[model samples]
Target: MQAQARGRKARRWIIFGTIAFGAVFLVVGLVLAGQSVSLLNDAERARGTVVGLEWRKDHSSSSRRNRSDDRPAAYPVVEFTPAEGTPTRFRSSTGANPPSYEVGERVEVLYHADSPEDAQINGFASLWLLPLVFGGLGLLTSGIATVVALVTRRRSRPRRSLRTTGP
Candidate 1:
């Protein structure tokens, strides 16, 4: 009986640990996915100008961060009249970098034609990271929740059979 109790306690700890860890990952993934969604919404409302291209030093593609960091990636920020527009800049991970476009280069951005402000550079809307991140997260959360539920149900079943013979 004591061993049984100990076993149950151990199982409970395992479940608790699994739930906590899974929840943390789920939250992070959801946050990333949510941000991507928000970016899309903002892009739809964009009419900003090519304020300038910022070479962000921190953007990296290195397998492991080392003495030599990944070269800065180029991103553009365009300013719109009246208020700043949202859709601005471009990103790519191809081995070759996009040509350096200058501040005054005349370029047209594609956006929600319904609302000019809601827009994006035509070629850039297909970023894969957002979808992959969300899909993997949804799968992980579902699996963990399913396992925890099954363990809980199995543990609650009574060991004795519900039958009686009366003399």
Candidate 2:
């Protein structure tokens, strides 16, 4: 009985901890989504070209690599002429392993009127990826927590024994 009580207490603490962790992720995801929406509302759009690719070592991959499979990630360097400023060139914050863009390819750019240097490539991956990932994680965690709580509650309910009296 003491062990059972201790286990129940531990389970409750785990559920609370899971909920808290999930709430933090959800809050971060919502904040990021809000910032992205605000940027889109206040940003100006312009046409840009992929001037070049800035290649960087793939630190996320394994240290040991085969000769033929070792390729760095390619981040696009875009050049655009803002409405009221001279031509500007900025490297995108997002990069891909297989090179998402080619040199001389035209792409849409989003920037503030005053700060063209901090421009971003206007695309789903560039703006929405982080928020979606965090939000999905939060939802998934919360859902698992809920399922566990429900199962625990069902199991903890007292079961009555059937009794029969013969006359």
Candidate 3:
């Protein structure tokens, strides 16, 4: 019975963890998707040159193992100045190896005319891609977990007929 209780507790924790992760992913995905739409809607958009690439390596625990044999990777930060005279920059890696876009390399940028601060270097246009991928994974995990929980609960319930007195 103790073992069964432990098992049930573990299962409950798994479900809770799965739900928390799914919720966070869904929220992030929605926010990112909304930003992408806002970017697409603004009529005042312009193309800009890469100008320069900001390079940096992430030395976090996750990246430490990945760089065991390879040289440190460089991330790119695309810098651009819109016709509106506002300066903008987007780090290609978000936080990974800075893209190797050399200084003065040309890369397009999308910006909002009214608020040039709301700009992104097309170099990382895959911004939307990230949210979608994570959101999908979360939803998939949530669904699988819900199904498993339901099936487990169903199979665990005992079905009996008191009318059977032969024993």
Residues 59-140, candidate 1: write the lDDT tens digits. Answer: 4545645546456556655444322333334432212135445566544454444455444443333333545565566558
List TM-score per model, in order. Answer: 0.45, 0.84, 0.69
- Candidate ranking under TM-score, highest first, comes to 2, 3, 1
Model 3 lDDT, residue 10, Cα: 94
Instruction: Give the 10-residue window scoring lowest on summed lDDT in candidate 2.
Output: 58-67
How do the residues 11-46 of candidate 2 rate in per-residue lDDT, one tens digit apiece? 999998897788788888888899889889999999
Model 3, stretches more than 4 Å misplaced? 2-6, 62-66, 69-74, 77-81, 86-106, 114-118, 123-125, 160-167
Where does model 1 exceed 4 Å of error? 44-131, 134-138, 160-167
Residue range 1-167, candidate 3, lDDT tens digits: 99998999899899878878887887777888787776667635666565544445445667566755644555555667778676677655443344445656676667766766656655343457777877787788788878887888898789876785675
lDDT of each: 0.55, 0.90, 0.67
Instruction: Judging by TM-score against the true structure, name the best candidate.
Output: 2
Model 3 TM-score? 0.69
